[model samples]
Target chain A: MTAWLLPFLVPFIVMNAILGIVTYVTLLERKFAARMQSRIGPYRVGPHGLLQPIADAIKLMMKEDVVPTAADRPIYNLAPIVFVLPCMFIFATIPFAPGLGVADLNIGILFFLAVSAMEIVGLFMAGWGSNNKYAMLSAMRAVNQVISYDLPFIFSALTPVLLAGSLKLSDIAAAQAGLWFIFYPVIGQLAFIAFIVSTVASENRAPFDILEAESELVAGFRVEYSGMKFALIQLGEYAHVIGASFLGALLFLGAWAGPGPEWLGPVWFLITAMLIFLLVTWVRWSFVRIRVDQILALSWKALLPSTLLLLIATAIVVVWRGVPGV
Target chain B: MTIAAPRHVELDYTGSERLTMNMGPQHPSAHGVFRAILQLEGETVVGVDAVIGYLHRCHEKLAETLTYAQYPSIASKTDYVAAMTSEFAYVRAAEMIGKIEVPKRAQYLRVIAAELQRVASHLLWLGTWCLDMGGALGGGATIFLYCIREREMILDLFESLVGARLLYGFYQVGGVRYDLPAGWVDTCRQTVDVIDTRIDEYQRMLEDNPFFQVRTQGVGVISRELAQEVGIAGPLLRGSGVAFDIRRGEPYSSYEDFEFRVPVETSGDCFGRYKVRMAEFRESLTIVRQALDRLPDGPISSRPGLKSVAQTRIPKGEAYARVEGARGEVGCYLIADGSAKPYRMKWRGASFSNLAILPHIIPGHKVADVVAIMGSVDPVFGEVDR
Candidate 1:
């Protein structure tokens, strides 16, 4: 009975912790983006806007859930839940520190990548069920964009898997104990760059964020959603972004391997993850969004072929050097 | 029934369904209260039906009711983004028909106000144009905030000069109502100098940026012939290789006293328009500095201060006055019947003419390019609707 309850308790705790972190991550992004834009952002709530997210959460919960009359009832109602589940589920496989995560599966990278891509299903459901043209158009663009970028994202993630000779994310993190993958001469740098570019595109950030372009599509697939549903969709997006940052930290930046005491490993991992998140956020705030055609052309003509080539080169190097752990 | 008689059927699979999307009057990037009903084939715009008059306040009819003394203030509402120039056009038309001799000092002061208004208006155009293209949450907001920072300084200068920030009724029938206050020139000089450096910073941020280039370059091509045929004015006209500027072609308000260059671009694309406005920023600044250095000391008004609504009356005649407003050539056509109020007043709003080119050039472009082209056109609906 204790063993069964423990299994459930850990996941419940992890989910709550992630929810808290995701809310704060939004505050962090707002403050950071505000700094870049030369203004103070969200300083009226708690001291320095620390409790702004909590206030926002309460406000969203209290607001009435508005449903469009023409909406496909079941799909519109369930889309946010479905969209948010996969985003949070990706975090289950990410090893925040060695033996510190909810579940460190053997097929960690693959699980993370596949689960992250599943958000598109919920995204499309929301777009199609909203019965709005902007939502429908944005949903179509999301399907095209997410499917195209996923390949390059997978190819780049596979580079670390190839270097470590392990499918486990813990093994990948451990292999970078000697030197972080980002500092590995040429191949690692090239693969890391590809990973970041694909991450930005897959995350629907600018200059690749043409789907929910505020100037054109308004809020895009989530335009019709209000109250808790809008909050859920926003949570899923930030959770996905945070999940990618964690994966990037583990894959390239030697997560949990910084200089400190053994117990401080998780702190180092959090700091590293935050740094990666900031890097992506910086890119998002620095460029205008490209057109949908241009975004697709970039993914196919530039990111796909180059990441494939880099993956092949990594495979060749791994075979020659007999893989690090083996 | 179809299976019983399977005749050879011709199916047109090449033609896709056209989506009719309404953008504006409530859009985030509509710039103002203007709407475009776009017929879209996939993402490409096949046709656009623009709708205006959401902001119309019957300024022409108001001109018929209000005297010349009161109309200049209302004229500022037409092109509220450049209130000084809008008021300039109306008062210049009154003075033209009335044959009122404006003092040299007043004319120079008008030049200073008009040039400063140009800088402020162009700064606003740059900010909103980037905000429309780049988005409110992205790098476009960065540029937008920075541009607004500089524009605020210019507004502060206007606030000091006219005691109003946005819509200033500084011009009267005969001359400007206010003279330069003590040490205002020093403050004006300092503000323009700071804005000059700030413009360089904006150029560094956006000019040569690949994202900006991809969005603007060759996106909205207004051919030289098309621009002339459509009767577009100001930067839209200059951008398309037309060297017709009201300031140079027909100088008014002692514009001939100051020397300046009008920038022209032959490309006639969005980027060309962007370049024309940026160059105009520097040229306007130069004019402000020159006018400040040579500001003569004399009375600000040729006529006595207004004591009644019908103090300034025009003889029965008609005259057209055009000023190089920040948007384009803001012209006022007035016909007075020996009364304090005009019998008929027609406003030749530059944005109104500039927007006419939209339907001519908008077809065959994507939905995204629509905003880019509209941003480049920079239509102030206050003028367009009026």
Candidate 2:
């Protein structure tokens, strides 16, 4: 039991830290967007709105958790937790710094991908359990969109795996020590673009956010959720975004392998990780959401074909270059 | 062996339970507090039933209690987005029934003011429609803010002419209550010139955007025949290839003197309606420029009299008059029993009749198309439920 405790305790600590960062990410997202729009955001709180999230948390905590009498109680109660837990689980394999990861398992990449898929199930539960037609409709869209886009997403992810010759995330990182995959220049460029597109869709962010289009669906699947439960769902979303960004930086941009010795390696990795997250957020704030069919069309008609070609090209490059021993 | 089996069997018309969804009298996109009960199959809308009267302020009943002089102020709230058109139509109706002829100079100023207000109102619709389509971060709001900046200039011109900004009761039974201030015409010309430049820029950013086009085109198609059947009017009617602009047909105020064409589109889809509204703004600009060019010099009001002018009492009769409002033909039916107040006042709100077609239009569209249809119709709830 004590032996098992160490492994369990490591994930608990790592997931919580990621969760805290995600909360601040939400606040920063608003602040960055406000500055872009030429308005001050949440400034009346403690010192440049550092305490705004604290206030929000307290408010959410105190509000009555009203369960709709018409709702499916068991699923309603389970939805937010399910939505949040997979996001938390996704953090385990994200290599934050050198030797700082929670899991260095051989199939760490697959572990993250499979766990993220649970977000669909969780969102479905929220929508179906709410007993609202809007919720149900939104849920159906969420499932359909996620499934449709997931194919290209997973296919594009294969490019880096082929190049690295291992599904283990740390090994993939070490493989990119000589040259980052994005440095594969043009075709490598195509794969990176494909990866970013898929990841954003997978996380359910803007430009592919048709599932929860507020004007069209009225809060979408989260329409019936209130108070802390709603906040938990939001926290899960931000966590997924941050987690995905870190993994993207790891896979394509080279994780934690910066200019320095091993001890100072983790700090540079954290900065790179932050920089990647900022880049993703900038894209989120700058673009309008595309239509559902456009996103689906992009996946099947454009990205899928491009990803297939890139995978084959990367495999050719890997075989031609004579593989290395890490 | 008399007859072969029927080639096609009719779909079973029976009691399959239809899912009913209530889209509110208080829902965000119903354009105010207007309720629509949508009967759906899965996500497809089978039928829609609208229940209005939620915003019914009983304006007609309120008009019965107010005098002709007091009536224009009350009517301002009916289509509150473009109050000038509402006030103008009511006063025109009263003047028509009362047998008072407004001066020619004031008529040009009225045309100028009303045309400017129409542009401002249409610009507002453009902003809201884009915002509805693009949302906050999509750069959708960039166009909205830009439009408001131009509209503010027009509103400033209104302030210069009338003292108030939004609900200006400048139109009187005889002519107008106020005269144009010094340098007002030149200032307006300069403002309109700047607006003309800005409008071109906005078109470059938004009008040609393929995403914007795909979102709008053929989404909410209202056939010309169906539009006539449903009693749809205004830009919505004109979009269906109707050449029935009240300004062209009846030639109210100084509209007959203006050389502007009534903008029309043949498709009658949401995109066609959007294009019509966009062209109408340019036509209004032409009308404004013409009115400025040919604005004659004279008194703003006529002489006061007991029956015709002074006493503000209409002759015992009835009259129906309409002016092409920003939304459509805003007409008023005034019944005068030789009283200070009208015997009966009924407004033919263009916004109201235009909104009635939504139940017929939105049944086959996706939920997103529902927003597009409501936006293209551009119903002001204050008018619809009045």
Pick by lDDT: which candidate is best? 1
Runs with alpha carbons beyond 4 Å of true place in candidate 2: A1-13, A35-40, A46-48, A256-302, A321-326, B1-16, B135-165, B180-198, B289-298, B303-311
TM-score of 1: 0.97
DockQ of every candidate structure: 0.76, 0.36
In CAPRI terms, model 1 is classed as medium
A44-94 per-residue lDDT for model 2 (tens digits)? 789999988888888998888999999999999899999999988887887
Candidate that scores best on DockQ? 1
Residue range B283-322, candidate 1, lDDT tens digits: 9999999999998999999999889989999999999999
Per-model lDDT: 0.90, 0.80
Relative to the true structure, candidate 1 has a C-alpha RMSD (angstroms) of: 5.2
User: Backbone collision count in every prediction?
Assistant: 0, 1
Q: Please state every model's RMSD to the true fold in angstroms.
A: 5.2, 5.0
Candidate 2 residue-wise lDDT at B339? 80
Top TM-score prediction, candidate number: 1
